[model samples]
Target chain A: MTRSAVSHADLTTLSAHKVRAAIREGAYGGHTAGLAAGKLQCNLAILPERYALDFLRFCQRNPKPCPIVGVSDTGNPHLPTLGSNIDIRTDVSKYRVFRNGALSEEISDISQVWADDLVTVALGCSFTFENALLRHQIPVRHIEDGKNVPMFRTNIDLVPAGQFSGKMVVTMRPIPQAQVAQAKEISSRFPQAHGAPIATGDPAQIGIADLSRPDWGDGVQIREGEVPVYWACGVTPQNVLLDAGLPLCITHSPGHMLIADVAEDAETTILTTP
Target chain B: MTRSAVSHADLTTLSAHKVRAAIREGAYGGHTAGLAAGKLQCNLAILPERYALDFLRFCQRNPKPCPIVGVSDTGNPHLPTLGSNIDIRTDVSKYRVFRNGALSEEISDISQVWADDLVTVALGCSFTFENALLRHQIPVRHIEDGKNVPMFRTNIDLVPAGQFSGKMVVTMRPIPQAQVAQAKEISSRFPQAHGAPIATGDPAQIGIADLSRPDWGDGVQIREGEVPVYWACGVTPQNVLLDAGLPLCITHSPGHMLIADVAEDAETTILTTP
Candidate 1:
């Protein structure tokens, strides 16, 4: 069960470059939450060029869920703008391989399957915004309880692009009713990190009949006086891509992400390389 | 030359739907600045499906310059999501037809060249953000001077996507140096409208050689104690599409835009049909 003697806590102290280097060398294959400290962590998707265009469109059309921080050139594995010395093939804790729209296997390194037409997409994760919420004294239930953010498939239809189409999926956090607006403002600052909650009160309005049972990730407690606030989740793209039954697809394991060198700063406004 | 009895200002008083109807009937072909009042005005690009995928990727990669508001399905002229009864063939003030990357001719309607493989791309215009600036009491030099906003070709190299690549084009507005930060915050609220100024003060930093001689549009004076603030322009995609010398391309004539039904509001975060 124990893959490394060095803990994730130790990885947090190291620079993002070092953390990525360790991952690339097969030394670290653990969840990336809170790792790389202040830098932005990204959810990863690797698809062939045939699906890349459509997938990119889907992300653009649905910005909140799939805020793209970096996209690698077709057949190229390095994300030069996202981080220094970045290599998509071997810099993740684990990659979930999908074939014909089904989970086929799990692997730590995807170098064996890397292809000339492969394209890598890096989407913003909620970790950055969650950190912001914590700093502002707002509760991120799952992080406090040590579980994945609860995600549900909703009746809300996403704007379809090409062969990719699916129902919108949202991650739910129960925020105190009074603090909902504050949470919205804080998260809104990071547009790349799934900015702001889409809906705040009843889940039934979005067609989520059950709050405890999520379609993806683990569920968390909704303390009294707190209401469920939903933000579009990164899993929506993966869900849609799987439904397309692409010949092959790969995504980072939940919570395990690519730690890019991009800092959470004022420069997000005038991003040139993104 | 007077083409119609109605002035551009006269049309601005009409609803967006009525304006599109008038343009569809070949009644008006002037610029669309301030038209539709509160609605989002859009720059237009129509291309064959063969080039659409790349073009879409190009917009997503360089979001600031080519902020996409709506896109039509291939060969479909109706932008159902942008406005009611919207027909790309005849909705705008004028259409500039390009052949092999060179300007071929100008027309009010594009029905003669309508093809099933054509895809329409709607980009966000600066008008929305300009209105925002005015509302916040910030100076928009061109507006005050009754001239087109000065636009320059910048040295900033946009992130290349597929076969689409080009330098960044910027629209310059002179703001009192003290209000630069205020302008940035106000415009930042409208991400769909190119978000915020990419740079301020030194035009040479982004490679604009002369403020008075703009590559496109009319220039306004930079008064004493005022600084030139530059924003990523919607003209960027058109420039790249032209440079590619594609076999066919159609765009909204400068200052002539497609009027869409989207309102400037909080819903930009949970964009449903964008």
Candidate 2:
């Protein structure tokens, strides 16, 4: 938990600030899964101010896949609401650079490509709900295998806004048939974390033809008695944005997220029943 | 419920499309209170395309006070997502024009002032929850009095986004002491409609001094054994944007709202508990 260079194995017990400090100091370079245990972690998308508005609209229109946790002011790298001294350029452990709709580079720091017109968008990641599922005795497949959650490009076309448009991308988890309801109920508590499963039992229903092959991230085994459950993924925005072929776009590498200081409860659309 | 130039007294039984037709044909010119019962109603805000992003971000950050139900594309009058063939230009019964942050004109139709760069935003209104409250046998002071719900500017500062910033505005309803919990529970189910009460019992806590005076709508009576309950109002954005001094901004006049084809459940953040 110390600010000293820490290994990925020790990240789960650390505070969000400590984890980010380690990442900033170049001490950690792994995916943020299970890190900063109960704190909010986000998917990052940095783009020009011009596309920021439309992108924001896209998020607004499709909130389940694009729950905005925090947004930085134009040309500002600091996200004060998410955490103090949270520099967007250096805090994330890994960054994906896209140019003209193609993967151009993978880097640990974006300080070199930072621009005044760039806007930082922090979206809710599935870490919260994954943690919730774990707490409820529901197993998460990718986490158990120490791999990134399997992601697939689906045929579900996102509601377009301005020039931003694309099919939705989803992350799959293998949930035992008996635990699916418990998983759904628990995950539904965190809408910012993509809420509950959009599809269960059949991956082909949402256009994923293969179980072992994924468009992004590592694929996990779906065992007997387990249903392949799909939740709208955070990688969706990045996938859609990349396909838009913008002159420039940057996002957190899949599974490598930005740790935020706020609790999951701080900014939730809490649905409660009487 | 028939759409043949229906009177306000008979409007509640009609569908959203019928209600919009009535308004579009210049038949309904009154506040939309109690109309289109059981359906979603929205507070409308029309502004130049330039300010839409900041305003949307403002809504993103402060969701309880500014839950957006539908947003029109730049220069597009149609909101197909909210309803079929719902034209933004003339569907609402009344429109308030703001010029450089000042109230300038109150008109029946905005077609004369509509421009290609203008964007229409529809936010959740309290009519849905008020109907819920009434159906639950809880008396709504404003509805019982046949007046617009009393609205007040609060001391609570909203989270700022871009050029949009201001204190939240809230509507006050005096609920009987015993039913306040039930009212809160019922209202919590409709986050698109300003969610649950932000404050109850004392108006002075939120900077309101007198119960007989409201900044916007008519004041209602608080009887013995009743407490004034408040919910974040849709007027906060209109109030803030008006204070921002935009050259041309239009909004639904106080108590008059746009009837959307969507149900209250369609666009909600949908908070749920196991």
Candidate 3:
């Protein structure tokens, strides 16, 4: 399908599978913040099997920032449990190839680099909760601004496992003081999507120095009566994986993600079966 | 520290650290239910570092049956984050030692058998939720009768990883018809302690044949107007590890546990730091 065939505005009406097919066919290579509606979109982190368990533990240890949404079997690109016909190698619009913890290349497909020892881990993203917040009539400033959510690295140290360890990265959202509690209540139900806010009020408390200049994404203006709320961001795993100095790791670029078949609020405790 | 000096009734008021101390000193060699009220009591699984990652993955894949509360570093006997001075080798009242996936001995302490490559995993238990249920004025039949909770092996296929895989083991609790919703709400808050029920109303749905003859623990009578609710039990990891045929494995004997310093209702996410 051509870019004109599936217009940017019409992307929202398309099913997740169609969107993935477009991405696989190299038709779309843009952010997927609101494309899949109510479906769960996941941040991708594919690593060698040698590092898979340790990385899984890192997510388990720091679930606030790195909630495990779906994990594929080692060497298998198909996340069958998470989505029908989901191919981790080429489903995402764009991919970042990290070699020895450094960005080596940008690619649209990882089929050539896929190895039998590789494992794909899909972590729940803020988009899931953002949708829930929107459903509850809570304003999401980033979505409203049509910009990527501002993310910052904090002093909060992630519990390390093996070689995967680093400071947590958090996404900031400005919420009116009145809706902060309601926002938390709505988002807490989506624990697979980083759950509730990790910190509210001053970003300085969590070691974030400036609101104007973020480490990642675009900064949003905090209104007079609004407090800067922070939720653990999925970028955490990507940041840690880069720092982990692994020989090879592949992750979804910025807003590109693997759209899952799961409902945003599906019970995270029992999503898998073997 | 004589056993007679620390009466079972007096145990309830003791602090978790103190209770662990008494157990370490050989003063307490019995079940740990009601002893550490409000504090989290964890089911222990100690395995070699070789099997640690796969087991951790199994737990991650099957969180409902194996909610990870604490994981000790490789070869580390102390779980400093979970408690002030938790020595996995000697803390629990009783331990079941498995060799080649079969029970070889039941011992009070594992110091003699402890190895340098061993790792300790602490899984959240139903006792935490049971305490919450009782506090909410919900009846817990097992606690009422001073009997062990009924546990059954279900047909639920656990998400497998590496050499670890098995069916889930669930504990049954009969909730009154009117309070089932309330019971679910209260229990849902304790995700670290298996969260909400996996199945309710029927035993046959999950493939349990007989409620009276449970695979583990004592069977409780399902009274009139009460529906049988099943929560993923901690025994799942044990069952899986046994089936994995690992060279060495150790687990807390039924009813014995490692009392953690964390509050049962403490935030499940963001629990650890390096």
Candidate 4:
């Protein structure tokens, strides 16, 4: 097949606002890893008001995997706090719709099926801290190899909230033994971005039975003398939400996130509004 | 008037479990400030399931003032996470019942009023860090003067969530100008206990106009060379809940609290389950 002439990759200099605008208008629908440069990108979750409280509590109890950056008001889709012109229904490049614990559809926009009672939740994504890691000379294995970061279901049980309960999910990165401390220190400063590594050195202790296979995302090679460092992944919430079998739920397609205007360093606390 | 011979003061040496047992049996119905010496004491808020979500969100957003230590399962009064045999309906020395947001009754226990729909919320109290401050020889003005800590409603707006919105409420402690940094450093370790000072020096920045008066609790004298340090108070959730005018709500009476089995230092995070 011939390569497409117009693509998100070609617009390297586009601002974060412009990227969001392009996604909103269906101009670009691919992954958004490097689209917005220094801005914070967020994982999106939308659900009905009836389940909003339990979901919010789930995030609160499990901050490691579900650090909430922005929560929309009940029945409101506008996340004005995260971005000046965010419409949850159409802001993301792609959305995975879930119904009764099953993936029902994959679409670029939900404006056609939008409801008045929906509440949107935005969680801090690791992409923010990954940028920080690179700037500090701490290499992220998957990013360097041009593949999705390996994510595994762990044995660490999440502190349950209402009907939301599950073990935590973690993402792994191969870091040189010497740079372990430095990488951990740099990432620890961004609490919104999952913070420091939850586990280092051993994968068996966290219940990852295999290195090459991951529950989500693709695995990368661990070079000689490098140790696997794990940080809580944002996928835990989406998985828990799906397992609850709610009547309706929506989430950003993996890697397709909502780009916020806030700089990565500007976001310090969770649950703060505009 | 002369005070009664038998009082909570005599139960100083009692274990936290024993103290709770006595409170449960209606043996002691006074303040809980000095009891349970090394254990954690908590502020209680009980509401119907319908209001639990919004209330929890309110706490999550305003963690400084409303740090939650334990949240009960819906329709359950047992806070086993805080204590092995804790019964939320009867654990505290005194209970204040509110209906339609108005004070309705003051009771020794809520066993009769307890409903299957009630969800209990436990907030971290200042008593934990005050004990730490005292151990470090940092003088607490209210303690030295033998009066209640001064509390004021600040102009700092709380991050609102679902019908729950209000200004922050803070407790003022007078500290020597030289020890302000030390006090902040020590208190910051206990995020569950409202953490470090939110405001120092002029009260006007946080909306307080006078040091001589307080919205709640008695005001104490600020000696020369001392500055007032304010901390987010546990009273915030109670105040906001009342203001929301819910159909039903219950809280620990002023100064009366739930004495938990957990040690003050054992608690590190907020919103653990019970």
User: What's the CA error at residue A141 for candidate 1, in Å?
Assistant: 1.3
Tens digits of per-residue lDDT, candidate 4, B90-191, equal: 878789999999999999889899999898888899999999999999999888878998899999888788899999899999999999999998888677
Candidate 3 clashing pairs?
Answer: none
RMSD of each: 2.8, 4.0, 2.2, 4.5
Q: Higher-TM-score candidate among 1 and 4?
A: 1
Best by DockQ: 3
Q: Name the regions of candidate 1 deviating beyond 4 angstroms.
A: A1-5, A265-274, B1-5, B266-274
Model 2 local distance difference test score: 0.83
CA displacement after TM-score superposition, residue A110 of candidate 3 (Å): 0.5
Against the true two-chain complex, what DockQ does each candidate achieve?
Answer: 0.35, 0.40, 0.42, 0.26
**TM-score for candidate 4:** 0.85
What are the runs in model 4 whose C-alpha is more than 4 Å off? A1-19, A34-40, A81-83, A128-138, A159-162, A178-191, A261-273, B1-19, B34-40, B80-83, B128-138, B181-191, B260-274
Top candidate, metric lDDT: 3
Candidate 1 local lDDT, A5-46, one digit each (tens): 466877878998888777777778788888877888888889
Error of 3 at A233 (Å): 1.3
Candidate 1 per-residue C-alpha lDDT over B130-155 given as tens digits, one digit per residue, 9 for 90 to 100: 99889889988889889988889999
For residues A135-220, what per-residue lDDT tens digits would candidate 3 score against the true structure?
88888898899788999999988888888888989999999899999999888888788888988988789998899899989988
List the candidate 3 regions with Cα displacement exceeding 4 Å.
A1-5, A269-274, B1-5, B269-274
Interface RMSD of 1: 3.0
lDDT measured at residue B271 in model 3 versus the true structure, 0 to 100: 36
